[model samples]
Target: PHQKTVIDVEKDILYQNDMLAQRNRGYFDAKNVLAINLVSSPGSGKTSLLERTLTDLKGEMEFAVIEGDQQTTNDADRIHATGTKATQINTGKGCHLDADMVANALKGLKPKENSVLFIENVGNLVCPAMFDLGEKERVVIISVTEGDDKPLKYPDMFHSSTLCIINKTDLLPYVPFDIEKVKLNAKRINHQLEIIELSCTSGEGLPLWYSWLKSKVLAPEPV
Candidate 1:
């Protein structure tokens, strides 16, 4: 959320949560891991975004995923089907993923040097933004079908995000979504937000996403 009250709550996450988040982030940093927490509602194309990213970045950098869901391993299976490593975190009764769950999920993973880890949060826009999973960046994905006003409606998700993705741009022709308006609304909430809008099915504007990702995760580290 853009409100100061939001920070008040985030700053006071449980001690266990803070400890684990720090530990996990430290583990990631020690391995040169760039962890990205991907958050959005179900059907917002979170998996599609991951699929596209892994396909384009596999050769350039080590990639893996932690799929969070309320009950199944479906998302993880899809990630594995793409020939990349993946872990499944079933939250059972929980709607969002927390650091402890993430730390537990990574326990069985074989160490990948210089890896880029992607944590796909349980499909929700609210609770997920409250917990930190030791990610270097938090990314939120929204689609036209979900509405262009999503940023203002879910300001917490947008405010916590390091980048915002507008998926399913190809559907724009049949939808009433406005790219400029969405960007404007998102920026009004978080003026420094970075955005990328693209269609997962048709690949329209996908290059922009890939390029943006490369600049963040694949670009040469400070020399």
Candidate 2:
């Protein structure tokens, strides 16, 4: 019965996490905050994308960031450099940020009403997929240099994510990555996944990303 015990413990953990996530979701709803969880592997350019996003959208909307890392606050520092309020959650040995951690961070972040809260999850495409941190939307980024078959390799992450960001497109000419192949592979895993190709350096396809964010904020569904 060891396997059964392990399964039971896993279920208990998820059940507790789900409860906390619902509480977190309710808090976000009460504050009218649009929370987006950004997940990806290391060097996927999540920080760069957020830096640009906060910079370009400055004076347009109130924004806050919860940067997750296993150790340093470097990412949060970078985000703060953009003049956006940011809190770093050092997960220590944990590979992923759970609902409890996010709920605790929320107390300090205190993102204002009608503002956007971006949670840059730990740079891991594995464990993050199983934890729901009470986000209204989830974005997964994969750099072109990371190969085009990421969707097939990390099906859980791609399947759970609502949007897939293909970053580092400026190097596409040099890389053997096929953008269309990535889209097709991801779609095969998740037909509803919205894909966007962007280059943080060249500022290509960013307008569409911004427009998508605006539409989600302006037309948020009932909580």
| lDDT winner | 2
Error of 1 at 140 (Å): 0.5
Question: What is the lDDT for 114 in model 1?
Answer: 72
Alpha-carbon runs more than 4 Å astray in model 1: 1-13, 218-223
Model 2: how far is 33 from its true place, Å? 0.3
List the pairs of residues colliding in candidate 2.
Answer: none
Candidate 1 per-residue lDDT over residues 73-179, each given as its tens digit: 89999899889999999999999999998998888864475778889999999888778888988989999888889999989999989999899888898998888
Q: Which candidate is the best by TM-score?
A: 2
Clashes (candidate 1):
1
Residue-level error in angstroms, candidate 1, position 177: 1.1
Q: Each candidate: how many clashes?
A: 1, 0
TM-score of 1: 0.90
Error of 2 at 5 (Å): 2.2
